[model samples]
Target chain A: MDKENRHHLWLTVPALLSIGLLFSAYGLFGWTSFYRATPGGLGVGGDFTFDNYLRIFGSWRELAVIGETLWISFALTMISLVIAVPMALVIARSPSRLVRSILLFTLAVTFLSGGVTRAYAWMVLLGNKGLINLALVHLGVIERPIRLVFNWLGVSISLVHFLLPFTVFTLVGAVKNLPLSVEEAARNLGATRMTTFFRVTLPLLSSGLVVAASLTYSLALSSFLFPLLLGGGRVRMVANHIYERLFVAYDIPFAAATSAVFLVLSFVVILGFAGLERLVRKVVVR
Target chain B: MNRRSLERPYGRLVPLTATLACLFLLLPVVFVVAFSFNDGAYFQWPPRGPTLRWYVNFFESERFMTATEHSLKVALIVTPACLVVGLPTAVAIARGRFAGRDLIATLLLSPLIVPGVVTGVALLALFTAVHGDLGLGRLLIGMFVFGLPFAVRTMVADLLGLDPRLEEAARNLGATRLRTFFLVTLPQLKSSMLAGAVFVFVEAIDNFSISVFLTDERSAVLPVVAYQYIRDFDDPTVAAMATLLIALSCALVFAIERLIGFERMMHINRK
Candidate 1:
């Protein structure tokens, strides 16, 4: 082999080794699920069977977790779009750089502060005697602290905060990359701001929003801490359930089966969104 | 009259919503910082006067200090490992004249596509099969698996973004392949490498799902320990520790901004 090919061969080794180990681990995890879990629990023993998959799909409990995960991801992604698109517009197109920089800094802090701290922060904020409750009580809006923590309300708010920066980032890119000239032409033809925005701008933004929603949906689906912490054990998502199946229930086959299914579902949904994005981009976005 | 009517549709509404959105982004973070310095030990509605009690208490505590030190050590090690592994992977994908490089790159980054808890479960099962004990070795391996994706993405983008002519000019002048890479290419890539290193370091320290499963009584990282403390206690010490981490992350964001420009740094987050 020549110098270049030799270098290429050598350079590819580390990537292969790194990816190989993970794939094999996942392969092992997937391989083990095909077998029945031992009666002793936490161990897969006995003959191999398709019972795990059948159990996952046939049972209401397992199917509910799957349905809940998808529904929560979808609902939160839509809510995030409502909040994020306006912020993206401000961050990307506003005349003020000071506003942009401050918003960006807030996003960076929110995005990078890690799950434990963010979860803790929300607990402190949304707890019974927390800031919102205090303010509401003082204003006579309520006579008592409503239950927010350890429920859907708490989880949804915190999850939205977690999902916001990502959607904003994606939408910011879309907003900045907009074909402004086309909008300018619409305005020259006496199109009002609202008409120009909804007609000319929204179509162009569809692909970017699809990308943002895909990312947001995937991240929401995998969320571990928010539901675990803020949901107060009541709003358990698939990730939390997977953990419980092993440590609490000692059901290793179930966790493995669920996660294998989780992995495949993520690929299908994310890849489905990927195809939709291309279709949107092809039709009108570009 | 014309301008007022023309803008009446959502003029005031847009700015109001933007302001609320900004506040929402900072709301939880602001609370975390505020309560960290609370003078009291209670979880009451109004925390007492802000004081340095928790911060001092945290610093003086051995368990907290030890966990912090351990996490830092692991992060320090994981950051360099990522550079060593991810750089070559990035280079091969970006500059190599090889086929299936795209496919290889996708597979390398596949870990990010799945929920990390799945990987945590998989790694837990795999490590247990090998040996039923959790130690620094298994913990490091788990952290490294997740950290490598960030490093590869940043470095690959940086390497691809460089002016190809700089390296080509050196080659045309008969600089050896190794020499040309170090002399011409490495200089331009330094800032992004540092940026990627900061990311990997923070990720290693912040990683919880993977570490949550991998840690034992003897091998617990900060997040794992902090989580346990939170579960057991109602004090502000973990809050103090979290404040310190937030400060460190914010500083790194600023530092990275100065290094590679903030927009470029944010691009590392995108596909």
Candidate 2:
């Protein structure tokens, strides 16, 4: 063999090993979803069956959980877009490095502070006598502490926070790609700034918006902690359901089945958005 | 009249909204830091007094310390493992003109797309099915699996972003492909590699959904232990530990920004 060929062969080993191990790991995970769980509730024992798949999909409870998960994910994505698009616009349009860095720093802290810590922080903020409640009471906004925890409201708040930085990062790329001159020309043509933003800039930003929403949606859909901790066991995200099936219910086959379905569903949703993004690019970005 | 109406609303509104949004985004971390030093035992609003009691308790407690050590050990080991296994894949993708490249890239990065909870449950099932006990080895491998995508993504970005002419120039001067890669390409990847390593390390420490299933009583990482502690005790010790982690992460982010520039770090997160 030639020297270059040998080097290519050798260099390819680690990459190949990584690909093999990853595929096998996921493959095994996918493979085991087919078998029936052991009666002992320890592991899979019986022959392959579609019963596990049937159970997860057939039950209304499981179906609602899936629906709720998708709803929360969509809500999280939209909220993140509302909050992040403006900030990302500011970041992209600002000529000052200081402003960009400060914004970026806030995003980094939010993005990197880990979900558990973020959840705890939200707990402090949203607890019955938590800061927000206390402040609201002091301000006479409410007569009593509201039930923020153990509900959809709490889940949405935390997930929005968790997903914000990602949305911002995605949007920043999109906004940066937009030419400043386009907005200027629009304004010079007698369009109002807001109109220019809504008509020209936003249409141009459709691709980035889709990318950000898709990312945030997927993250929220698969979210475990916000629902587990902040949702206070009352909220039922698919992730929490999957966790219960595996650890609480000791139903391995059901858990695996749920996971396989979850994987497929997430791919479908993400790819759907990617397709939407392509469509938007074709129609609007031109 | 037109300029005043046009400029005043947004000029005032944009920064105000942005500031408020940033504050809302940052409030949670600020609260974690503030409450960690609270004199009271439980996590409650309005501190009794500023005190380091929780920090002392966190450091002095053997269980918490051990969990912290476990977290550090896992991150330390997993970062290097990711680099070794992921770099070649990144190099191959960047340099090779092979078919199915995009497919291969997607497969390598699949872990990032899959939910952590699902990955955790799936891996736990696989481990138990193949081997009875979920050991530290299995946990390490699992984490390495999770970290591989980030490492490869970062390295691939770094490699692709660089001018190819430098490596090509070295090769034309008679340096072997291996030597050129090691001397020319590897050195250039140092900053991004450091950033990637830090990212993976933090990920290993921060990972809970996957680790929770894989971790036994004797092998819990800090986040899992903190979670259990929160479940059992309402003390500020977990808050204290969290504050410490936040500090460490901030420091790492600062270092990464210094090493590779902050914009580049943010760009690496795109994948």
Candidate 3:
């Protein structure tokens, strides 16, 4: 036991170093957010103030961004929940191994592919001159190209696809635990297929949906690449807002202040979801 | 495999939903790959004609190649470093009874919870102040923070599933703890290590949100370069580069599927 304990501490050195590095950086970020941004200056030592925080709250533009971030995250999670159920049922309940593996393979590829590649692919697929529009025009679905890219609709579409793999994987286990007998029983009782799914499967899936929602919400909240590549400065989430503020305007303090707020906001929202998920599980179980 | 799956059949709707989901997943990847081969100098819906010129151009360009090199250098360095730091922590989490193990695990895994850009913003601020303008070294530290959690999570899951009796058996035979780990335990961890290595390597190379803020021209990774390319030019060179990544990621999915079973591999991230 003593030897084992020694090995344990020895093993944590690298983790300790990692934490030490990150926290010190985080400490610096928080510390820097307080300093007054000297005009015509790179970082300079000066008296600390709440000016950075005040400035973010002071501006309607920044508050709008924060609101947009929350709205988008919520919408993304709701959309994911709608889609994760059917996909999870397929993955967890498919009779053919080939079909299951193929679906899983598609998901793995989506999950494993680089963010930049995925983002670029969306750009090509959704851009004004891109495939979807071109195909639509050729088929006489529309004369002029629809506004698909550079908006919430395009961002939501890409991000929902981006998020499906994780959300499905989260809910798959729950689907597996559900007995086929229950659905079969409902079908035998003269319930239609759609009725069986809605009345039988979905309520049972409530807890799983909530759990997956928490995961989806968190992933959506951190979404950066899709919004950055596809949003075209129209729908700036908090991360991009911070990026633009820092790089475009060279406002380091404000960026830090925004990040600090984002961090707190994410924690509160995720914690709320966690609490909700637990309550859901308890209610579902009872 | 679930034996029930052998007996149970999904109706038409499930399969239909799943197919559409696959198409939605595959279309972006397909478009990117297809456009890379387009002979047009501009963005054309259909290829003007098929050609290998863009792929050739990507390799010949010093700018893209150097960014690829920097990406490779960062991933190669960060993967092993993640292993060194994360392996011990994973072992502790998997087997140790030490105080503060939970806290350390949470600290390492915090990157999953916190927005990755927070790390980028924080590290950029801190590193800029301390080093002013250093390049890869600063980026390395940033990558380490993000990479450690994944590295730790993979090993922890693998280690938990490992039978603890093997190490005890080695110890009973008078092998030292280090000897047991190197000779018996480490060998068993080979699969997890391989999976983790591939996962971390790809993650480091592809990661942008954190790395973006930390990189200067000298330290920019492939994604940053690709991002810049698309922003500046309407050319298809970035598509070629993206195709290469798509192919590599496809190969990785298949590789993990063959070696570790793709679902098990994904479970690491799910955890």
Best prediction by DockQ: 3
Q: Interface Cα RMSD per model, in Å?
A: 2.9, 3.0, 3.1
Q: Can you tell me which runs of candidate 3 are displaced by over 4 Å?
A: A179-196, B1-8, B163-191, B266-270
lDDT of 2 at A257: 84
True contacts kept of 1: 0.56
**Every model: Cα RMSD to truth:** 2.7, 2.6, 3.0
The local lDDT score (0 to 100) that residue B237 gets in candidate 3 is: 90
Name the 10 consecutive residues with the lowest summed lDDT in model 1 chain A: A1-10
C-alpha lDDT of candidate 1 relative to the true structure: 0.83
lDDT of 3 by residue, A1-286 (tens): 7666756777788788888988998989888888765566446457878988998889898889998999988988888877777888887777677888988888877777788888888887888888889899999999999999999988998999888888998888788778878888777677777887888888788877887888788889888888998998887889898898787877778888999998999999988988887887787677
Residue B165 deviation, candidate 3, in Å?
A: 5.0
Report the error of model 1 at residue B119, Å.
0.2
- What tens-digit string does per-residue lDDT give for candidate 2 at A117-184? 99887877898878888889989999999988778898888888888887898788778778766776
DockQ for every prediction shown? 0.54, 0.52, 0.55
Model 2 regions lying over 4 Å from their true place: A1-10, B1-11, B43-46, B132-134, B267-271
Error of 3 at B166 (Å): 5.3
Predicted candidate 3, C-alpha RMSD:
3.0
- Stretches of candidate 1 exceeding 4 Å from the true structure: A1-6, A39-41, B1-12, B132-134, B267-271
Write candidate 1's Cα lDDT for B204-265 as tens digits. 99888888888887787888888888888888888898899899889877877776767665
